[model samples]
Target: MNRDLREFRRLERLCLEQAALSTMDLARTGLLKVADDCRAAAEAIEARSPPRGAFAGAVQALKRAPLAWRVGARS
Candidate 1:
């Protein structure tokens, strides 16, 4: 997963550079296609990974915590 992310980042950067230098429509379109492909690949990877963030962590912890402990907690 890490390696795939790195590769996608690299390809995305390369495509951006090529797109900038491209003077013709066909070349720019090709670079845009490559960039879109990299974006899709990255999205696919992220979808398979568990959610991240404080809310997600709290939800996960709540799921793992005992029901008695959860109900007994005071605010």
Candidate 2:
């Protein structure tokens, strides 16, 4: 999922770059629209997804827990 997000971002950049280089108004407008759509999609996905470090945060929280709070703690 992270990889896919990065790919969407990369595609947005590529579209913007190509738009900058385009000589025709229509082509540039189309490319810019495509880039905007990619950016919007990426933002939407990112907003709905957990942060990349969410798993690490969970692990860190577990580390802070008392030994007895961990799994398989003895009675």
Candidate 3:
């Protein structure tokens, strides 16, 4: 990837990290709005820079499993 794309990827990684933390909090609170916001964060990252190869499946898994359960291999 180009320099600009690499920078964008870095930003997206930050977004995903924040989203993960938010999701954990939302899950504990059981608040739909907060959970939705976290989900939106994930969507925004996907929009700007979709996951590559093995990570593509990981992103999909996050849609189903709880954030805490997203461990092990990339996929």
Q: Encode model 2's per-residue lDDT on 1-75: one tens digit a residue.
A: 678789889999999999999999999999999998887678656656654597865754564465336434755
Lowest summed lDDT window (length 10), candidate 1: 62-71
The sequence of per-residue lDDT tens digits that candidate 3 reaches over residues 1-75 is 345545555565555556666648655354444545555555455546655667886776675465445434436
Output the worst ten-in-a-row residue range by lDDT, candidate 3: 65-74
Higher-lDDT candidate of 1 and 3: 1
- Cα lDDT of model 2 overall? 0.78
Any residue pairs clashing in model 2, and if so which?
Answer: none
Ranking by lDDT: 1, 2, 3
Q: Rate the local accuracy (lDDT) of all candidates.
A: 0.79, 0.78, 0.55
lDDT of 3 at 64: 48
Give the TM-score of each candidate: 0.65, 0.65, 0.29
* Candidate number with greatest lDDT: 1
Give per-residue CA lDDT, model 1, range 36-57, as digits (tens). Answer: 8897687567556686988986
